[model samples]
Target: MKISLVAPAASLFAGVVSAATGPFLTAVDSQTWIIGNEIWNMTQGPKYGVKLYYKDHDCVGNAVGHYVSYNGAANDLAWTSARIVKNGTHSGVPFIDILFTAAEGDMHWVIFSNQHGSYQYFVNRALPTLGEFRTLWRLDNTTFPNGRTVTKDGVLPPLADYLPENKIQDETWRTPDGKGYITKYDWTSWILAQDFYGVYGEETGFGSWYINPGKDYYNGDETKQELMVHRESATGDAVQLNMLHGTHFMVSSSDVFPQGKMWGPWLWYLNDGSRSDALSRSKTEFASWPYPWLEDEPYQTRGSVSGQLTLSDGRPASHAAVFLGDTLPSNKSSLDQGSTYYYTATTDASGHFTIPHVRVGSYGLQAWSGNNSAIEDVSSTFTLPSLTVSKNKETDLGALTWKISEKKKLFQVGSFDRFSYGFAHGGDPWQHGLVSSCPANLTYRVGCSTTKDWCFGQSTKGNWTIKFWNPATANANKSATLIVSLAGYSSGSSSTIWVNDAVVGNLTSGSVGSDGLVTHGLASDPSLYRSATAAGEWRYFEFEVKPGVLKEGKNEVKFQLTRETQWHGFMWDAIKLEW
Candidate 1:
C-alpha cells in the first residue's frame, strides 16, 4: 500500500498557489525563483551561505534534480539540508512535504503540529503502518525476526529493491576462508541483504553495526565504490572513522589494519550465539583477506608530472615538498573542502620528484623546502606558461630554481618554518586557561629569554614588550626591515607593531578569518584533531625601522593585538631584524 499524505485545510500552509511564503516563492522561470527575502547570502559564510536549487514541477515548470553550491562554486548535492518538497493536495491546495533520506539510505519524515501559537515539528519513519503521526521525534520500529523481506512485517525492504538493475548482484564475492555460497542475486547485494536481516533485526548485543556505502572517484571517474561500515559499540571497543587519500570512503570497525585500496569493511558482532573467541578469529580472517592493494588503474586517462627543485645557491633542495594545485577561491578557508584536485610529492635526494596518476588539468605549481635553522627558509610560487597535462603523457617541468631574498641579519627570534614550535605552550596550544593563569603583562628579553618565557600565542588585547640591546650606534641612513611572520589570525582583528613610541607596521585584515588563538592549530577545529602545526596560512608583515627608532644601548619593541577578544587572536611564527 502506497501511503500518501495531505495537509490540513486551514493552517500556515494555506493558499499555496495564491500566497507567497517567506522562504519559498513562486518560480519566475524553470531555473529561477524570486525569493521574498535573502534566505541565504554569500557573506554569511559556508554554514548558512550555501545554496541548493531544485525544481518544483507543481510550480508550472519542468522539474529537475537539485544542484548545490558554496558561495558561487558548484558542490556535490548529497549530504546537505535545505530541501523543498511538495506533496499531495488538501482541499484543492498543495502543501510542503517533509520526507528526507538519511545517509544510511533510510526514509524519514517530519510532521508539524500546533503548539501555543506556532508550529512544532516531530520526526518518524514510514514503518509499521502507523495511521497517526504522534510518534514524537524518534524512529521506534522494533526488529522483526522473520526470514523474509519483512515488508509485510513492518521492516525496511531489502536493499536490493532500491538498487539499480545492473548493481543488483555480485557473484564473485567469497568469505576469506574459502567458504562460499551461491546466491541468485549478485554476491555483493546478497551479502549486504543477509547482513541487513541481522542489522535491522534488534539484538540486545553489546555492539551494533550498520553499512554506509560510499563512492571514490579518481580524477572524476566514479567506477570504484567502497563500503563504509560503522560499528556503534557501547563498550568502547570500536574505532572512529578516518579519511584516506582525501576520499570520504571510510570504515569504522575494530582491530583491523588499513591498507591502500584493497581494504574492505569487517564486522565484529558480539552477542548471543556468537563465538567467545571472535576477536582472535576475526584478526586471522582480516589478515587473509588480501595482499597489498592492487586495483586496475585508468592510466590511459590519467597522467604524471615530474620536476626538479634547487635552491638559489645551486644546491639541491632534498626532501622538499612540491604541489600541483588548482586555482584557489578568492577567500580560502583554513581547510578547503578536503584538498581535492590537489596533488603533492616529495623530492628525492637529488631534488627530483614525480607525481603519479594525476588527472589531466591545468595546475599552478608551488615548492617549499623543509625547516633549516642554519639558513633562511625558501619557497616559490611559479607563474609559468600554461601547464596543460594531457592523457597518457608525462609532463616534465625540467629544472626549476628558487630564489631566496638576501638579507644581512642582526638577530632573529624564531625560524620561518611556519609554526610556533619552540615558544611556551606551543606543543600543547589548546590551554585556554593560560590567559588567566599567566601574567597579564608579558615581557621577553632578547638574550636572556628562553622559549618558556614567551607564550605560544596572544589571546586578549594587550601590549607585550620585547627588550633588546644594541652595541652599534643608531643610523637612520641605513634601511632595516623587521619581519613578523604569523601562522594564524582571526577575522576583523588587527596587529600593530611599535618601536619605542612610533608605529611601524599594521595588519588590518586577512583573506579569511581563522581561529588560532584559542586553538593553536592549522586545522579548522581542534576538537576534531589537535594539530601540532600553526592555525592558518602563513602571512608575513614587514615593517621598516626608521634610523632614530633603534638606540645604541637599549630599545623596546612592542607587539600589540589591538582588536582582540577571547575568541579572536593570532599565533606568531617568527620575528626577525634584517638590514
Candidate 2:
C-alpha cells in the first residue's frame, strides 16, 4: 500500500493511550527516566491520569514538559516509541511497559510488543520474549434485556485455557532455561525506579527487576506494591502467545515470596509469516481471544466486519455509523472528545456496514446516526453488548436496534467542506508539500490542498494523496464518491486520474459521466486554472465513486497524473471524498 510513506494519521485508539504534553507539571507526581544523559518522564496527574515528557532539542530547558506533543497521539505512538529503538512492532516497542486500569476493574499490566504485523496483523521469527504479549477481550451481556447483550464485561482467559494447541509460557526473564515464573518484587515504587533507571536505563542496571508498575494495597501492611512481569514463548503458527502477568512480592515478617497474577492468561500473535495469512488463521486457532476486524483487506487478511444497526422504533438506520471503541477508557483520554472510539463505518440504505481486516479484540460496538456531533440522545449513541469478531470471520451484528427521538431520512454524503486534508505524501514535489512550487500569490498550509498546488506536468509517474475519516458504516450500495477537478492545464487533452486501482475518468474537460462523475479542465474554460495559454489547465472534474468501493475509518485518496505533452501546468481545485 506504500502506506508507511505517508505521514501518520490522527490518533484512533483512545482508550489505550491518550495524547500528552511536556513540562509534565513539576507539581504532579511522575517518574523520570534517564537515557543517554536525557530525562523522560510520564506525569501521573493528581486530577488527570498521565502525561509524558521528554527531552526535546527545541524546548526552553531542552526538557519538554509544558506543551502537548501530538507526536504521542495514538496513531503515532508506535512510531514515536519505535524511533527510540532500532526496530518497530505492531503495537509498541518490545518490553516497554505501561500500567493501566481495566475496563471492568482492578489494575492490569500490558506490554507493548508482539510479532503482529504493522498495527493489526501478525507475523513470525522469534527473538525477544517481549514479543509474546498481545491483547484479548471477552463479550459480556449481563446488563441487556436479553440477559446477554454484547458488552466488554470480562477479561480474556489465558491462552492455554481455551486454545488446546497453544503452548504456555511460565519462564522467568533472568532464568531463561528455567520455567518462567513471577518473583516477588520488593523493589521501590515505579517512580523511584525511574529515578534510578534514567530515560534509557543509563543509570543502574538492576531497574529491570521491576519493569511494569503495579498497585497499592497488595498482600498486607504495604501502602503500595511493586510487580515484575513474566511470560514464556511458544513456537509454530497454530499456538497462541501468552499474556505477560506480574508477580507481586509477598512480604512477611522476614522472608519474601512471589505470588499473585495481574490478570488471567491472554494472547499475542506470532505471525504465521505475513499479517494477512496470520489473522485469517488466528481466528480459527486462537479460540481464547476475540478479533472483530479479522475480515478486512481482501488482498491481505481477508477479515471482514459487517453489521446492521436499527433505530428504537424498528426503522432501518440508513447512513448510521457503526464503529469500534475500547471497552475501557484510559485515564489518558482526550480532554475534548471524552470517548475511546477508534474505528468507524457508515450504514447503507439497508442499515448495513461492512469493514474488513480488523485486529482481534473485544470492542464496544457503537452506532450513531446524523452527524457525529448530532449524537445527543443516549439511545442514538449507545453500545451494543460487546461484539466479538475472529480472523477471516464476518462479525454480523444483525438488526441491532437503538432508541431514537425521530425518524430521519437517509444520510446525504457530500464533499469535504473546504477542509484541508490532514495528510499527504509521495515522490512528487508539488504533490507532496513543496508548496513553494505554487504561484507566489497562493499561501500554503501543510494539511491543505489548493489550486496553485497541483501535480507537475512531468512525464514520470508521481503520486499525491488526500484522506478523509469516514464514520459511516459500509454501504454495499452507497459507497463514498469523489468530487475532483483541476484548472489551468493543457487545453483539449486528457489527463487520467486513478482512485484506488481503477481509472474512473479523464481530467481533460468538464464532462459528467452516467455515474455522475465530472472531469473538467481549463481546456474548455480558457480561464480559472490560469490563462488560456497555461500548459496544464484541467478544470472542474468529478468522479462518482462506484457503489461498494469505499470503507469506514481513515480513507486515503490518491491523485496520480501523467503529462501527455510539454504542457507544464495544472492547479488542484477540488479533490474531495464524498458519496
Candidate 3:
C-alpha cells in the first residue's frame, strides 16, 4: 500500500530564544570575554562605563565602538562610575563592577572582566540561603553586539541593529506606527525584574506589579488583585501573555513549596516553560458527523467484507455500510424475479451482518452510511464452498447404490433374480424343464449332455429346470430375446433346447436350438430357457431385443435353465437394457 507524504511548513520562530540570550556561548581568549551583552547594551548606554577591548587592532573608536569608553578621565568620581577599563590601566581600573551592575535588576548581577586575551562573565544573585549564584547569560564579542541589544526592561533588541544597516530584521511582530514603545511594559521595572529574577515580586512605588494578563497571581496584600487584561476581544476564550520569566518562577515555586498547587491550568506548550491552556474553552468548535461501529469479528471468509462505522453523536452506529460492491442488497433483485441465492445485508441496529449463501468465488463488499458521505474502502477476497449449491439434479442425493455384474460384463445392475430350473423330457424338447417350483428349497439340478461325464459317475439322463425374473424393463419392444451361451467349455454336440412364451407353469416351444445354440425364434417370450451343453461349463444370457411383454414403466422377465447333474453349477450376469 502506498501512502502520501506531507511536507511540513517552515517554522515561524525557529531560532527565537525564549531566554534573554542564545543558549550557547564560548570565550576564545583572556582578552575577549563572551558575555550576554544584550542586557547591558540595551539597559545601559553604548558608551557606558564598561569597556570591552579586543587586542589585535579589533577595537575601533566609533559611536557603537568595539572599545566602549566613558567620556571622562580615569579614577575620578566621574571616571569611577564613567570610564570602563579592560586591563586596569592608569587612566582607570576596568570598572567590571559597573558592567556587572548594568546587567542587574533587583539583586542579581553579571560582570565581564579581561583575563589575558579572553573575558569571562560571572553572576551574583541573592538567594535565601544557598550561596551558589546562577549564571544567567553569555556571548562571544565576535558575535555579540553583532546586532542585538538588551533593553532597559531586559528585552533583547531586534538583530537588525548590529547587523549592517542595509539588512532589515524580518517583519514578524507587527510594529505599532508612531508608538513610543512596542509594548506598554517595555519601560517598566517589573518587566526588568521579571527578566532577572524570573518572578514578579512586591509592587513598587513606580507602577502596578506586572502580573500575567488574565492570569491569577497571589498578591502580598491578599485582598486586592491585579492582572493584565486585553481590552479587545479575541475569538478564542483564553488569551496568551508573555509572562517574561514567570514560567521559571512558577516551576521554582512549585518545587520550593511542594505542598501548594502553584501551577494552575497552565500546561507546558513545548520543552520550554511557555504554556497554553486546554482548548476546552476555545471558541473554535469541531465535530465529526458519524462514528465508526465495527467490532473485530472474524469474517466468514478471507474475501468476506467487514468494517465499522460511527454516528454523529460519537456513539457506535448500526446499519452504516462499511463496503459496497456486487455483493449487497440481501433481498431479491426485483419483486417479479424472486430472490437470488446470493446477496449482502446491513447489520441490525447494533451494526452486525453476516452474508451467507455467496458464490464459492471472489466477490466485493462495500459499506455505506446515509449520514456521512464516504468513510473508507477496503478490498477483500474470500473462498468458501458452503456458499455454493449443486445445479444438476432436482432430487436430493442422499445415497447411491452401484453394482458390477460378472456374468454380463455390465456396469450397473438395477435388479437381478436368484433361481434354478431344468427341462421336462419330450415336452416340446425346449419345454422339458420344471421351473422355480419350490421357494423353500435351495438346491437346483443341472442337466448334462449325454456325451459328457456326469456327477456321481451316473449317466445325466434327466433334464433340470431353472427360473428367474428379469425386472429390468428399461428396454421394451422390437424382438427382444434371451440368448444363453456357455463359457469354460468347448461344445458343438449337445441336444437343442427351447424358449417359450409362457408366463407361468409349463413352457411351449417357441424357438428350437441347434449345435448347443438357442436359435432366433419367431415369437418373443416372457420366460426364457436354455439347456446345458457340457459339464463344468458356465452359460450366461440376456435379452437380445426387449420382449413385448415388458411394459413401459417397469416389467420383470424370468429366465430358467435346467441343471440335471447336481455337480454342475450356474452363474448369472446382471440384465442389461439398451434403448
- lDDT winner among the candidates? 1
TM-score of predicted model 2?
A: 0.22
lDDT of each: 0.38, 0.30, 0.22
Residue-level error in angstroms, candidate 1, position 259:
30
Q: Of 1 and 3, which scores higher on TM-score?
A: 1
TM-scores of the candidates in the order shown? 0.47, 0.22, 0.15
If ranked by lDDT, best first, what sequence of candidates would result? 1, 2, 3
Residue-wise lDDT of candidate 1 within 388-482, one digit each (tens)? Answer: 67787999989987676576666666656555657765534332223333344678898898766877666566787888776777443466778
Candidate numbers, best TM-score first, in rank order: 1, 2, 3
Candidates 1 and 3 compared by lDDT, better number: 1
Model 3, range 393-457, lDDT digits (tens) per residue? 12121221111222322111211211111112111111111122212122222222221111111
lDDT of 3 at 551: 47
lDDT of 2 by residue, 1-579 (tens): 000111222222121123222111122112221111113223222112223222322111212121111111111111111112122233233332222222212222222332121112211121121111222111111110010001111111222332323222212122233322121111112211111110111121101111111111111111112221111122111111111211121111111211221222122222212323433443443442232222223222334567776667666777655656445342221111111113456677777788654545466565554322232122225466566657678877666777754522222122111111121211121111122233322222224544334332222234454454556675535745455433223233455655556566656544445554445543232121111111122233446667756565544555554543222334332344444
Q: Which stretches of candidate 3 lie over 4 Å from their true place?
A: 1-475, 481-543, 573-577
